[model samples]
Target: MPNPADRNAMLEARRTLKMAQSPHAYVRGNTAKFYEWLAASPVSRRVPTGPAIWICGDCHLGNLGPIANGQGSVEIQIRDLDQAVIGNPAHDLIRLGLSLATAARGSDLPGVVTMRMMEEMIDGYAAAIHDPTSGVPGVESDIVRSVERAALGRRWRHLAKERLDAVEPRIPLGKKFWELSAEEREALTTLFAEKHVGAMILSLQGKPKDREVRLVDAAYWMKGCSSLGLLRYAAIVALKTRKGRWSYALVDLKEATTPIAPAAPGADMPDDDAERVVAAARHLSPYLGSRMMPVRMLDRSLFIRELTPQDLKLEVDQFSHGEAVRAARHLAFVVGTAHARQMDPATRTEWLAILEADRRGTLDTPSWLWESIVSLSGSHEAGYLDHCRRYALAA
Candidate 1:
């Protein structure tokens, strides 16, 4: 067990992380209530846990997306590990369910379809551990397909497209990620063809080609709220391990760890923060590939990954009732499995029961559970906004 000081510091880090990423009007409005709730809740301590391995700490809606495999086979994989940690299972479940609630604010599906979609996500997560290859029922391994499916989702299809006719996502990224500019096009070209990108030719995992391979720039884009002040880059590479087969690989590298935290007090020395984050991500996400370099710059850390087409995030509210229920259940199962992996059989079974009971409608979907998270998220958002306001006023 970690000492009290370390635990307190970690909590402070989380609050600070929130402030650094969200806006002020958002932060001030919701801060104190959240901290108070956390302090009062017995379950809160069970969360914010650590010393395990690889947790998607900030398991929010926007943080999840699509990514392709080495052969460009699209998978419903999770992305955005910037806030990942090796810690408490409760933290992930609470945050994930809370994000689902936030997404409920904008879903297009009635009730059923929304439940199904949510359930599918949870199912997807659980299944991933066993196969890591199962995608949607019939789609081939390709990024475009994942993007299309994610765009349509279950609720949108059931709503007959009526649900999404007017709704637009509140993606934090600028519009350019969905579009492209001339300079950005050129940059993508360069990244893919030179500088950074490559295919592994041999069946070996640790063996290197004994040479630096250049990649072409795949896209010009922007992403992540926490990485507002850091560098993010992506490149494309084609690999042909077999004699006649060829496939595209999209490699991406982004900066994580923000320059500030809302709930946490005191100024941060960015250099150290960047180092810790880069180290953690690299250490935890081994699939980030062996040769992938996590670079440290003056004020930021760069993380590398294969640009998979299957990456996607869904707005929970837009889904149908069924889809939402499904998604919730699906997410619940994944959270349960992750927790089970780190705990004793008894502890694992306990949470699994809680998750399954809720999913099967055996337990009343606790309105209070999601409400608390929203309260927490809202508070952090407020605190963050306050921090930003103070900065803007100073500037």
Candidate 2:
């Protein structure tokens, strides 16, 4: 962790600088602002009441990407669940729509292209609601395909090189990793000494379940936009198998907080925030959820998961007209599948009808969705400019 005296200030500076880089970056970093706008706007009342199910409360383009399951199978799914909750599914659709629209604006795409992307997004989502078991649509953009291929070919070496900047069995203390306090190190050592924690690491790599695990190295990890100020650590562990081979795993421990995204009224949820995040992940993104284990450290709730080389977020900074529309369809399809699987046949049918009923004669997409995107986009753009001005003055 950073020096306790300067941690918050340093992290706030870094977060602001990152969010000021582009409009899409701003959208990704400002989840609280997004929900606040929805709460204060009349548009919130118009959004259809979706079935109460687990949602990727902060669903945005940057949050969806390729993830590997415990068995090493790769699929596109929601990768972040810090803000997840049993909430209205329509909130996710609107959040994702805002992300796509802001990204289109960042890429300098015309307004008409953004409108078409929204139409395709609704079409793709409705398709999944109609048939949850159907395969992903074949209209993926070249950028997405390239990312999928890269994710499939990645291995431990790639992850070590990219994240740690080397394949050594230690976390280098530099820009991304910092020396941990003695107390922090001792807590991590005690946490990893538990039998269940050792078993979890061994199971991920198919090693002998009874083998002992050693914490080779640990550091305060600097990662994520919204999670910059939280308790984040990267710990590398080693286990020797009966065959005299050694296995290694990179574990990510992140603090969990109360979600800014509102949960459905009277929703029954776990009181522990970490437990809520873990449950949400399992329901919305099994590949990610399967690897997660909630734990407590220094009296704070945190969740630890083994990081796979194949897990990567989508980076859609620039988009052509064709790529724009295709990406909207494919990404929305992934989100729809997450939401649709939790609903029964009748519930899904009812949700689809609700979505379809919102479309006007000429507009293929729902007017409410389109209007929400436009309103949120305008608000965020102005917010971004104001944020940049303040950041500049601070610097």
Tell me, by TM-score, which candidate is best. Answer: 2
**Model 2 segments more than 4 A misplaced:** 361-363
Determine the C-alpha RMSD for candidate 2 after optimal superposition of all C-alphas.
1.2
For model 1, the superposed segments whose C-alpha errors exceed 4 Å read 1-53, 71-75, 108-212, 215-221, 236-249, 258-293, 297-300, 315-317, 339-347, 350-361, 365-371, 377-395
Query: How much does each candidate deviate from the true structure in C-alpha RMSD?
Result: 11.8, 1.2
| lDDT of model 1 at position 211 | 35
lDDT of 1 by residue, 135-220 (tens): 23321222323354653333312322231122231112233233334554555455444433333422122224433344423433
Tens-place lDDT per residue, model 2, 253-288, is: 988998999999999989999999999999999999
- Total backbone collisions, model 1: 82
C-alpha lDDT (0 to 100) for residue 285 of candidate 2 = 94
- True lDDT of residue 16, candidate 2: 91
